[model samples]
Target: MDLMFLRATLLFILGVYANSLAVAKFIATSGRHKVKVICFSKTGERAAPFIRQAAKDYFSEASFAYVLWREIDMAFWWNMFGVDSAPSVVFLKDIYSKPITYSGSFNHLQLVKMMDDYKKNDIPQLRLVSSMELGCDARGYSRSGNETVTWYCLILVGRAGHAMTQMRETLRRASDVLMVGDDSDYARNVNLSVAIVASAAMKENRLTFTWLDGEVQQKYCQFHLAPEYHTKSCGPSYEDGVDAPQILIVRYLRNLTDDNAKNDRWKHFRNQYLGDTKVASQLIARYPGPEDVEELIQWISHIVERGDTREFPYFTFETPDLVPEDKQSMGSPVGQSFSRGINNRLKKLHMYISDLPRDPRVGPSLLLAACLLFGTIWLQNNRTKQANNTPGDLASSTSSRGRARARPARTDDVPPSMTDEEPKDAYQWVTTDSDSE
Candidate 1:
C-alpha cells in the first residue's frame, strides 16, 4: 500500500511539471500577446479619441497608443516607416516587428476603410530576402552584392508613379506577405511591414483627360509607359508628338517628382550615373559581340525573375530573385549579362551612352571606391601574411600553436639529445669554423 501511494505521488508531480514546462515554452516562442500600435499626430487633439478606439476595438490583442511628435523621429521613425509623415498610424505586433505605416488623417469612414486594408496582412512568410539586420537602408549603393546583404525584408523594384501601382499590384498578389513602403507605419496599426520606394520622375506627365468641366487633373492614371519604346521626339502627351511615337522616358521621369524634390535628385542620379555614356562604352569593350544586347536581356530576365527569394534581401527595393537566366550564376555568361544591363540601356543607339555618368557623385564612383577599399584590405592581408613568413617565423608560430595543449614530457620520456649535452665533436666535419649551409 505504501509503495503504491509513493508511486502515484511521483507520477502526479511529473505530470504537473511537464504541463508547467509546456506552458512556459509556448509563451517564450509565440511573441507578444497584444498588438502595440503607434498613431502619430502633429495636429494633436483632432486624432485623439479615434486613435484610442482603433487600438481598443480592432487590435484588442495589441497595446495601441498614440505618439504625438512635433519633430518626427527620423532615426527611429523612418526605420519604422519606409519614410515618415504626420497624422499617421502604424499597425503591427510591436515596433520590433517593423509594422506597416499608412500616412495622413482621415474621417471616421476613411479611417475604417484604411484599417480594413491594414488588417489584410499579406506576405505571410517574412522572408529574409537579404541577410541584413533590422535598420540598414537596403536601397542605395551600400547594398551591392559584395557588401554581405543586410536587413532587407523585402525589396521592391521600379521607382514611384505608375511603377508604384504595378508594385502595389504585385504585393497584393502575393497573398502571404506584406512589404515596406515608408520609414514608419502609416498609422498605429502594427500588422503591416515598413519600407519605402524612392520617387524619381515621369517625363513631365503623360496622362491627359478632360473631366469635371474644364481640365481636371487625372494623375490617377496607371499605365504611363507604352509597352515598348521607339526613337523620336515624342513629347509628354500624345498630342505633342505625331511622327515620332516613342515611349518618352523623359515623361516617365517627370512623373517621379513630389513635394520632397526627390524627382529632381533622382533624375540627377539617373542622368549623371545611371545613364552615363562612358559606362556603356566600358561594357562594349568587355562584351563586344553582335548579339550582346539580346543575350544580356535574357540574362537579366532570368536573374530578376528568380530574385533573391532564395536568400534574405539586402535592401527594401532590391529583390534577391535570380537575375536573368544568362546571369543566373556569377559564371561568365551571367556576369556579362550584368555588364550588359549596366552598359546596354542605349546599346541600340549609335551614340554609346553609359548608364553611369562621368560626374563623381554617381553611385559607380562610390562602388569603385568600395571595390578599391576592399582591394586595399586584401593587399593588407597579403602583406601581413608575407611579413609573418619572415624566413622562419611562420613555421615556428604555427607549430607552437599546434603544440599548445600537448601533454608534458615525463622524465622517462625525455630524449637523450635534450637531456644531455652534444658530444664535442658531433658532426664536426671538415674542421671548418664556419660550416657550409
Candidate 2:
C-alpha cells in the first residue's frame, strides 16, 4: 500500500511539472508581433495584481504569461535569458531576439511604463520587413493602394543620440498634426500652404513617416543627401560633435496609364528576376530648414505642394534595402510552402523529439531496440554464411568444377580448321608448311 501511494505521488508531481513546461512553451510561441511578458514566481506564490491589470489594459498590444519556477529549469532560465531567480519578469519583443529581464520588484506605474515602452516605439524604424507592410518601399504600393499613384516618404536619418531623439519627437508631432482633422489647433496655427498640404495628405493617405539609423545605413543616408552634406549627416560621429539628424522627403510616381493586370504580371516577373529594383520614379529633396516643429512643418508643406503640383525631373535609381530587425521573422518561399503542407506533422515530430531527452524511458528503450536490431542482423548473416559453407554445397561446387576441367572438347562447339598464315586471294592460294603458293 505504501509503495502504491509513493508511485501515485511521484506521478502527480511529474504531471504538474510537465503541464508547467507546456504552458511556458505555449506562452513563448503564441504571440508573434505583440510584446510578451512572462512573470516567474515560486509554485505557491502569485505575481503582483498590477501585472495582471497591465496585461488586461494592454491586451491588444501585449501577451502575458505566468511561469512557476522549478529547480530543474533554473540553469536554463539563467543561461538563456538571465532570469536568475523567482519573482522576476521577462519582456520579449520578438521570439528570436534577446529578452529584457528585470529581477527586482516594481510598482504599477513602473510596470505600465515598461509595458508601454516595450509594446511599440513612438516612431517605428524602417526595416526591410516593415518597409513592405508600411508601403514605404518603392517596390510596394502606397498605403492607399494602387490607385494612389503619387506618394511621399519622409525619413529622419541619424545615429542614436539626444539630438536624434528630439528630432524624432518633433517629426512625430508633425505627423500627428497632419493626421488630425483641420479643426485642431495645430491646423489653425499653421499657414495656408501647410494646412492645405496636411489636409490633402490626410485625406489621400499620401505620406508615410519613418526613421532610419544613419550609422548602420550610412550608404543609404549618403545616397539621399548631397555629396557635401554626406560627411556632416551620415556615418559615425567625428571628434567635433554628434551629427545632427537630417530629414529626407521623397516623392514617388508610378505610371498610371499602364494596364493594371499587365503591370501586376510584370511586377511579379521583376521581383523574381530583377530583384529589388526601383518600381517608381522618384524626386528626392533634403530638408534644409531648422528642426523646429513649425519651421519643419512649413518646409514639408512646401515640398509636398511642389511634388504634387510642379513638374520635376523623374529619375530611377537603385536604393539600398533596409536591414531586417529580426532575421528569423522573415519568410522564405520554400519554408512557407513546406510549412503549409507539413506544419502539423512537423509540430508533432518536433514535440516528440524534444521530449525524448526528458522522458526517462526513451534512452533505455532506444538502446534495447538497437541491441535487438544488431543481434537480428548478426544472426541472419551468420546463417547465410553457414548455409553457403555447408558440406553438401561445397562438395557439389568442387565436383562441378572437376567435371568442367575433365570434359573433352566437342566438334560441334569448335569452328572449322584455318591456317595461321597470310590469307589467300580468290585467284591465289597460300601454301602451308611444305606447299608452295
Top-lDDT candidate index: 2
What tens digits encode model 1's per-residue C-alpha lDDT throughout 152-194? 2222222222333333333343212212222334312332221
In angstroms, the error of model 1 at 279 is: 68
Please identify model 1 stretches exceeding 4 Å from their true place. 1-31, 43-47, 95-98, 123-437
Off by over 4 Å in 2: 1-121, 188-193, 257-277, 328-437
Q: Report the C-alpha lDDT of model 2 over 412-434, residue by residue, as the tens digit.
A: 87765666454556356556885
Q: What is the C-alpha lDDT of each candidate?
A: 0.36, 0.70
Weakest ten-residue segment in model 2 by summed lDDT: 268-277
Q: Could you give me the TM-score of model 2 versus the true structure? A: 0.50
For candidate 1, which ten residues in a row score worst on lDDT? Answer: 208-217
